[model samples]
Target: MAASVDSPTPAASLNQEESTTGSTPFLRNGTVMSRSVKISSIPDPSLGTDERVGESDRAKRMKEDSLLLLRGFDSIAQNLSQLSSNLGSALQGARYLAEPPTLREIFHSRIENSESRQEEVEKEKIEGGKNTGLKRKFDPDERSEDQGNDFLNENEQCLEDKKLKKAKNLAVSMATKAAALARELKSIKSDLCFMQERCALLEEENRRIRDGFGEGTRLEEDDLMRLQMEALLAEKSRLGNENANLKRENQCLHQLVEYHQITTQDLSASYEQVITCLDFSSPTSSMMEEADNEDD
Candidate 1:
């Protein structure tokens, strides 16, 4: 009885082992399915509040970082657009400087008029002086007065001629200087175009660098791009200052040209007045001679 209680018979033991083996699969399957369902339905208790807080903080940081990147990209885009607009305006200014046909035409016409007027004045003076001197014989005292008046008038005419010549020379010089300035403007335009191309290349290189580095070197890439943008901004400011200076110089040149033109016009008007006075004086002198002949 003690042996039976201590150890089961082999058949009975074998039967019990077979029943346990047969029930183990169902138990394991039910327990595994229950545990899986529990895991799927419930939050993990092992994930602490600290870990959740850390995850939330990390998400917040990522969102903030994305916003910052978007802002930076927007700023960069605005800067690029401004730079392009500046370049375009500069090109337009250069083009205007290069092709000043209207100014050239005005200068040419004025110069031609001055030359023709000068020739007409010279011919008129020579013919009128010869005719007046040969046509009339006056009393000795009257002749002396006439000669003195003629001498004074000739001196005035000579001075006027000299002024006209100076004006013509100045106009010619100004035209030549304008041409030189135009050439310089053309060179500046070319330089600007080269700078634009270089900027484009730099932008392409920056894009390539960004693509190659992806997310790993994001901070380093931002720093590098920031430095590049700063450099570009500095260059743009310098160019803008130079452009402003050029504009000022162009305005000064235009003012000077206008001043010269006014002076030339005034001088021409004065010359016309002198010619009209001479014509009026000639008729008076002939009447005086006729009066003198009647008195004789």
Candidate 2:
């Protein structure tokens, strides 16, 4: 009776064990599904060949465009630096020119201030003398004074001519420089406008590529690599967990199978014992019948 009672316990345990192990395949299915999702998320080299080509070309074009823009900007910056220096020098020159007392004016004013009236005063003093000899001597002094005045006038005229020439040359050079500067500035402005438009287009293209695009589109190269690494790590962790679960389920199945084997062995031994008793009882009954017959 104890054996009978204990016998159902193993069977019941087996039933519970079977029920528990029956859910493992669902876990395997989940693992398979997760693996398949990972596979599907991977880029297919076969189908994405054209896309890869397009991406390479796009990257190349963008790199070239950016390089060109950078070069243009560098040149523009250099030109601007030079232009600023030139403008500063030009401003100083203009300020100097705009102020009073230019070299020519100073030279002329000094010449005028240095003019001598001493010859005329000496003439007047000599003419006021009563001696005829003094008058005769003063006549040559007047002629000498006139010749000195003519020489001063000639010197002034030469300085004026030289100054006028210098002024004209300076004015011509300044006009040329100003015109060239204006042209250069216009060119810079146009280039800047072109660069601005180019930058706008690049920004728009970048936005189009980044916004709402799949998988790695919105991510930088480093971010995408990091994300892929994280995904791989997560997958590795999940697979480890699944393997652990499988090991646990295998252990449970092994234990259940061991119990079933033990139960089968016990049942077989009991069957053999019952069969021997039946065989012995049959022979004993036959013998008793023979004895009874003989006695009668």
Query: Best candidate per lDDT, number?
Result: 1
**Against the correct fold, how does model 1 do in TM-score?**
0.45
RMSD of each: 27.5, 69.1
lDDT of 1 by residue, 1-296 (tens): 55555678899988976776578798757767887999898876777787989999999999999999999999999999999999999999999889857656786888789778878988997898787676555344466777889898888778887887788778877888787888888998898888888789878978887787765667777788889878877878887887898888789789979988888777856666767766455878899999999999
Relative to the true structure, how large is the alpha-carbon lDDT of every model? 0.82, 0.64
Worst 10 residues of 1 by lDDT: 134-143
Cα lDDT over the full model 2: 0.64
Q: List the residue pairs that clash in candidate 1.
A: none
Q: Over 4 Å off in model 1, which ranges?
A: 1-139, 211-214, 217-234, 268-296
